[model samples]
Target: MYSISFLIGFSLLAGFAVAASPDVETRSRRVRLSASVIALASVLLALFHLASGPEFFALSPGVLHVLDWMFTIGGVGLALVLLYFCRRIVAREWYIPVLVVLQTGLMLSAEFAEVTPEVAHPFYIDSFTVLMTLIVGVVGGLICIHAIRYMQDYHAHEKTVPNRQAAFYFMLFLFLASMFGIVFSNHLLWLFFFWEVTTLCSFWLIAYSGTDEAVRNGFRALGLNLIGGVSFAAAIAWLTFGPGLHTWELDQLIAAGSAMALIPAVLIAVAGLAKSAQLPFSSWLLGAMVAPTPVSALLHSSTMVKAGVFLLVKLSPVFYDTYAGLLLSLIGGVTFLVTSLVAVNQRNAKLVLAYSTIANLGLIVMCAGVGTAGAMWAAILLILFHAVAKALMFLAVGTTEHLIGSRDIEDMEGLVYRRPAMAAMMLVGILGMFLAPFGMLLSKYTSFQAFLSMDVMLGDGLMLATILAFGSAPTLFFWSKWMGKLVAMPRRLPPGTDPIPRDEAIALVSLTLITYVACALFPLADKVFVIPYTDYLGALGLIPVVAASIPWDNIAIMSLMLAGLFLMPLAFWLRPPRHAEVSGYLSGANVSGSASYRGAMGVERVVESRGYYLSGFIREDIMMRYGMLGAGVLIVVMVGGVAL
Candidate 1:
């Protein structure tokens, strides 16, 4: 009966060992082995903590004080570390360290003013905590496992960045360890400590290549997230000093949700928005694309950005009807619409994934702002589905890029005949993202229902719904185009020579299976995990109990719809011998063996067409400009409203 906390420490130690040894294949094996151990502990952690309320740990109050001092020092240490990493800009940007020192000062002040709370528990392992732990352990671990193969292929061509294998694995594993700590910690300051650890790890990884763009974007990420750290520190100070409040434990805050109002709560929510990259702050995540693919996948899917939405979801109760809540909904709605439009205007596949991640997270933020049990329910499911599907898509793109030397969606044309296995896997990810029966679309449908259930055309819910409707059509357009290209190869073409690496193939195939399995059993998943977490929120008086009536007929129809979406293309895939081989329309005589046609002067020409990016009509630069200005106005309004 090992504690998951202990097991995570063990994995961290093992990661250090692997990093010291300096071998990629061995590191891969050890990482997966550590992941397996974590996966098992996750199950056991769930078994032990089920409905077991607040089990106190054996620790003296004196040790707690020492722990507080450690984190205060830790905050300063992180500032120094960031300053070192971003040293090149320090001469020009003296305010960077100045702000960091200010944040550290606030944390130190909060540390001393905060008496050791009456409640001394360091951790809580509720069902939601358990769910988060599993995601970090499983999805995060899979990405790490996938990173093994990816980094190897990555270094093959990535000569600009000197090989830093040891540093990469160490940061990645440490990030996982910190994620476990973040999920379980009950004390607000302790949570902030782990939260900052994630920010630091991300900065290092994003700048791993050390190129001019990489380093610049790394600073962008660091500066914005440190703003979140400052906001988080201020929230702690306000909670410790403002009013009659005495404790920094989140559960206690929720218990007194009725008493807590805008000032401190809004501080915490603003930090979440920054971390989640909502609206005006989204440029960091877009800039994060300069990092390696696993870094992008890790931050977007399982860990960093997810942390932001998690905090907002946790604080959804405090956000129920205030102007702060209305503003959050507005930011999310606008972000979703703007990013979805921006996604269509990009040919870069990873950029498409980046924009899509921001868009989906905006939806999650909307759900949390809606602050109903059903909305939270959809928010949680989106977290789960997006993590896996996005991971799969990222890895697929990474593999495809290495094999073909391109990340453009148009280059992925004829992928079905060229890399059928990979094409099928990518299809699963794309379909899961937008089509029926799969978890993301199902969760979206639930979110729409939640929005409609609210006061339509009269409230924030209606405004959000309008954004959702406009945003969704572009999603179908872009995804359908990619899907069409993946299978567009003539029936008789032979497969490509580049085999997907063994480890990457394993990770991809496993995730594909999980996606289908999760879809098939989503009902059971809802019954076991989703319903209980929402019920817990109800018990806390945070939200009302949603109607328990199961939508069996809708479920049946959705199932039929998924079957059609899944089966029809697969049927076409199976019809090779019986399928007629036809060339793409050329409007005249075509070359027999290639995609070329005869010119009027009898010179051969290669005909090609690319997806319409609508570069002129729907420009990214213009969208970002207006989107940021609008979001900036809303934020100013929020602060003004709070001040008044």
Candidate 2:
């Protein structure tokens, strides 16, 4: 049943500040409590839906219909509230409350209405819907909790007036609700509306800092996503007017995936790539790092990027066997390989994560494009596992930045002593990202098998598959180096730093728990969620045979990981002589009373060692131009191939 009351509760939580005193402490406590309660209720709602099955629903025509209207009207109202907030209409402080009231009324109408499914079914639940609802409610809610403490520290440090905390939290909740609407909607038009809402939400969140760079990045993000929106709109129009593709329901569109389905399918795939931030479009995501940590976590982990992949998976049946499918796979593979290479050159921790996110997404997209049951299963599992690990890493990096005032991995060397808990948690998160037995690696392994099998059977080109395997090797190299640097031993702590914040510690611990639980549950999860999706794909003729002996056994891989894990501790215990280290080939006489040395002229100079950004080899400007050109070409190939 659609619980209007639950939506009301979240809306009320967002508006709690209006009724409370202006004191900071009271507002903080109220926000935290309200966020916690809303999260708990969301979890309960998710559980209820999962247990009750998708068919349990009220057939009311009154409240439920009203809720449907409210959803539409409230969307506009929220936009207005945001406009007012941004424009500084002090007289219209009431807009947020009015928006909440309208949304509540919409929920009430939807809940009480006994409308036919054909006319309007605002409240409904299925497995897929429930999954997304859980994510929005749980992950999004926790981020809200994090923001409460994070904003306090952020403002205190920035010393800004006209604190934007209230508006920020308000939009955060709206973002969550819009994400829920996106996945839950049966109608394509409604989903598109929600899709735009998410884009708007991202725009606001990215520019929340109100800095010039923040605003620039936000505009960049907006510009790129608008491309996705246009593609989405085109796809919808094609589906609506094209032969035998009239319905907007996902099930209907999938059911109609005949030989003629390729045209719209290609359009949809284009939109997916844009939204997912695949190679050419990835600059926006990199730019998005200018926003707050919570925004980054939400974008990377739970919402925007995932929507793109979700759409691809949902429409796999339509494009799998056609040239469109092959093209999609190729695009995904290229993005995956190139971005992983680009990630190698990044010193900024968040940029590394951002590129890595794009790279992993490319892998997932390629898997979906492979159009096999095994590949689809791999993609979904990757999505779930990557979300937890990536979110953990982002939050960890955010905490580190707050503590050390830097996100550069070079500067973060020997950070463990200063914030051991965060460092340890980050290690786990990174391990989940790279090493085997973890879900991301497991998915990658499965993907490799899927690609290999696809190539052998279908006679598809193996270029992409080979590139993917080759590209992935560097992933382990860079991640291991960075993780090692994080916990690298030093003689003593660096001077001038305070202890870590309690809220940050709590956030890290919670993220770790989630990541570990998700990893631990992978085996069981494979049985429940993955097996079914895989079986569905298998039935569609995409199953791949996984070879047992290729590179090494599980034990061999595990041993390597164990070795890396123990090496740091061993190094610390041994405390090898620091003076034993020799200079590089260009070494000169020591100078400046430190690591400095005399050059050719006997001049004192510092010996600087820096990691590669490889800008010359893969310059962003060059890459961006080429990436967009490639994406555009692919778009043409896909659409034309489908039309033909």
Candidate 3:
């Protein structure tokens, strides 16, 4: 079944990529068919995991050796190609590619010199891997479905760019395949190969428009991510070459618990931080807004960035409470606090999502560094809830932009009156992001508990908790502003129907419903998923995984909030105001019963309520430069901590 999952991913990927040059009808049929098969295969995969012997399978020794040679040579070639492009496009920033090439060479040398190691169970399964697969399979399939309608609108509006529909869908499927590989691979080299494939895929998708800005931003993503790839390769080299860690299997290495493993763990953590866009490295994601929104939904919410946090969380056992873990907490906490403050100063909707993504990821990383059962519990839930809410927001934003031709938060004013359905969807996403009775806030609350419970003797416990408190305040403010604008009423009604395409509607509703269902199932998920995972991984004494002690009153409070918050919009949409009536206090004669009123001179005047951006205190240039600088210095400290 595991092997079959790979086959399904690749088949769909190749089939979609090649179908690009075909007619639109042909491409649609093929994409829909492929999406079905991909989702079905994912379901089958979960079924397969239901009964297993914890088995590990690999090819014979001779075949394993051949595969090793193939991977090493192929990887080196790809690294060289990446370097060439990096230098060719941005000659002044030449050292980046050069550094990548050097790191690749060192990695290859170390790996090649090792005793021809057998690929021990090149693939395996665990509860965590299964969850990742479900995310990739389900969320990914929905995005593909949505993209069908989205690309049509995109091409209609964007005539200058070639209609590379086939190539675009192809990359999306290919990313899915790579994601499965990433979650399933037990071998180091195999994981890295899949990792770089995603990097290349992201570059292609980001640069799809072929605009100078698009191409330039794509390269920026490539260069930054390749640095991460280099770090991952270095980790593999150290694992293979360092003492008592000759194997590529993750379980084996963790079982060894060698102190020498700390450095390699740190290297992998660096790679994770970069992939997750934690601290100093979040610019690539913000720049990615230039691409289509489906791409943003995939990369930011479900698949790409999540890989980074997944790795860090998986490696929590290595550094928990140790110096390495404490250092990671510092990076995560600082990124969360800074990015949340920066998010408050954004007007662009996508940029807000981008910064919010970074901030949430930072919280996850901090939790992973805290390295307790409770923290891990919070981390997993955060990942799941975030994927649903963020994906919904991106798609809703994309639809809103198409409808109104803008992604500015201000332009969303009175959206509930204009595009009621889409506005309600956006509202649900917003509430899910910030308000109560939703998973994101629930996860953040859980994360706070995790941080507070961490041993304060480590010095990081109270510090991380403090950062989270400050970060969360700004998060509430920014989301509330957008939500307020979206729900604001306008006296003058625009005549139009909600113009959302059927496919797009399906995707949006799926994600929005997913948010609430996930919320309702939170307690059950904790017991069924979290406790079993903890038990399987051993007590580790990280935190109490006690499920029964959860507060029911809090759940009751959130349940009431969800019903009201999510349903109020539906009720409003069901019976949208027929008569444009008075909603506020104008206290005088008004021209249209709006914010404007006639003055003593009989001239009309308007009142404005512009949201705060904190421009003077937190300009983009100031925060980015400061964020990168401070993060860089602390990263050095983190690395040094690993060394000691």
Candidate 4:
């Protein structure tokens, strides 16, 4: 099944290249084809897994040995090819073909070899693996498709001297290939190699524009990720030498979960935290915003950050019952709360998205730390839902920026009048982040429930986490406010001043549709995937499943959404008094526009409202210093605690 999936993915990439050759056209064709193939593959894979029994494939030792060599050699070959291309490919387009070929070969070999239960099947696919594979194929493919239109606009806007688009597509495909490898690989070493590939791909992608800021951000991302790479290497080495840790297979590692496993587990968690952009190391992800909007969407939603959480979830059973789990939970929870607060103060639309991405990831990490059936289920659902909604939101914001010539939230006030389709999509995306029935909210509720039930850490730790979790409500307020500001109606505009791009509208509409489908069918999703996965984890004793039946209340949530959607048009139709007399406080004279006042010299001054970036309170410099310090100290504590 895994091999077949890889073959399908590779075939799709080939079709993409054939359909879209010559930069602009190639990108559009590639995106559409990739998205279609990936989504189709994911659904088929999921259905296959759910319907078929466990012993679907049989393997031989000869096949296993051959597969091992294939993956190892293929991985090495890929690294060498990437390095060679980085040095030689002036246009950079050739890198994509090279990367796709190597990754597809390696992933297929690994999948086929692991299908057999005998010969210590190193790579096996379970429900969770299927879920991740689906995400990589579907969400990752969509981002690639969106990148087609995005990159064209990006270059056209900049009017650069030398076009490096070939290199861009190369790196983009390589990134996708690496993401697929990371999610599917069972060997920790193979996973780490793929993990590093993603980091390198991101570094190159982030620096694609080659501006000083872009280069700087790229290097910063590399430096931080290198730290993670080092930790990952160390964990692999330790696991290799440790007794009872004979294999690097993820399932074997989980089955061998002993106190002795704590050392490598802690190291792996550190790497996960860094990769996920947890506080103190979060600047790398925020700096990633310097990349193009599609890259940002890919990084934030489907690819890079997800790799980290994926690792944590894959290893949850190995560490969840230990003190290491407690530390991880605390760290994830704290990062979540802090980033959420910080997001409220951001004015740059991308930065706001970046912080929200970090916050959502923190929540995922926290769920992994909680390690209960419910929490893990929440994490998986959030992973799926957030990928769709956040990707759509980023793309929407990107299109809005392209149309309006700015990415500032203030500039986007009353954006609906300008780009109704994009604005409406953004509104849905925002609601998905905050409202009921959306996976994010549902997962968050499950996370809290899981955390409340855990007894791993006592009193103060529990209380602090609970407090932080509850305080997250305020974070939703800012999202609502910004979303409201974006969709608010403008008083007037020149007819047809802003026109939406056809390609961009297609991307936005597709993303929004996927999000809505996911939201509406969440119950079905629970029944099909989440419940089974949760039951598996519960059987493993990694989490306790709580049975609390809520009196089936979908009507209320659905009705509220319907009412809001209807009322918006109804209110607009009423047009309550266009010339209504409203006054400012302090007996100020009314200015020309609504809510303005006469200032000191009798000059009319517009009321300039701006959300606080809180630079003074959450300055990058201070936050980086303190956050790294805290994270470093925790690392020490985790290591020492494990050693003892």
Task: Indicate which candidate wins on lDDT.
Answer: 1
Best by TM-score: 1
User: What range of 10 consecutive residues in model 3 has the weakest lDDT sum?
Assistant: 540-549
Q: lDDT of each model, Cα atoms only? A: 0.78, 0.68, 0.77, 0.69
TM-score ranking, best first = 1, 3, 4, 2
Q: Write the per-residue lDDT of candidate 1 for residues 1-644, one digit (tens) a residue.
A: 24755756865886696687656567777877776676667767766776564343534789777877786787778778876765676455566666677778888887776363554676776666777777787777778777888888788889777888788888888888888878877788889888988988988898889898887787778778888888888888888777766677877776666356456667777788888888788988988998888899889888899899988888877767666777877888888889999998988999999999999998898888777888888888888788888888998898889887889898887777667677788888888788738477767777877787665236656777788999888888888888888877543344357778887888788777777777778876676667787887788787777773547897788789787776644544455222234565575677854467786878887766677788899989999899988987887787677757
Per-residue lDDT of candidate 3, residues 1-644 (tens digit): 44544644564555555466458877877777777677777777767764443445676778777877877886888787676667447665666677677667867776767464455677777767766777788788888888989999999999999988888888888888888878887887878888887888888899889898998888888878877888887777777666656767776655544264678878888889989987788888888899999999999987899999988888876666566677788788889888999999999999999999999999889988876677787788788777778888999998888888889888787888788788878887887776636466667777777777777365557778789899999999999889888777653456456468988988888887877777777766665555566666555443345442458797787788667877876765677644365745665567666667777777777755678899898887887788788887777887877666
Between candidates 1 and 3, the TM-score winner: 1
- Native-referenced Cα lDDT, model 1: 0.78
TM-score, candidate number 1 = 0.94
- Sort the predicted structures by lDDT, highest score first: 1, 3, 4, 2
- Residue ranges of candidate 1 with Cα displaced over 4 Å: 47-63, 90-93, 114-118, 436-438, 455-457, 490-495, 548-550, 567-585
lDDT of 2 by residue, 1-644 (tens): 44534654454456545234377677667666666666676667665654443442344778655655665675566446544544432342334334334433433343334431243443345554555555666666667777777777778778853478767776777777677667666656567667877877787888888876787677667667766766676766666555665554665566566465667677777778878998667888989998888899889988889888888877776665557777788778777777787787789899899989998898888887776665776788888777777887888888788888888888777666555555677787887687535477667766777776664235564665686787797677678778867766532346455666665666667767776667666566655555544454345443333332335587457546654753443343335223223444447775443356788878777654455566687676665567667866876787787777
Candidate 4: segments with Cα more than 4 A from true spot: 2-23, 53-63, 74-119, 489-498, 553-602, 612-624
* 268: Cα error in model 1, Å: 1.4
Q: Across residues 105-206, which tens digit of lDDT does each residue of candidate 4 receive? A: 444444344332233444466666667777776777777677676777888898862467656666666677777777666666667777877887888888
- Model 3 whole-model lDDT (C-alpha atoms): 0.77
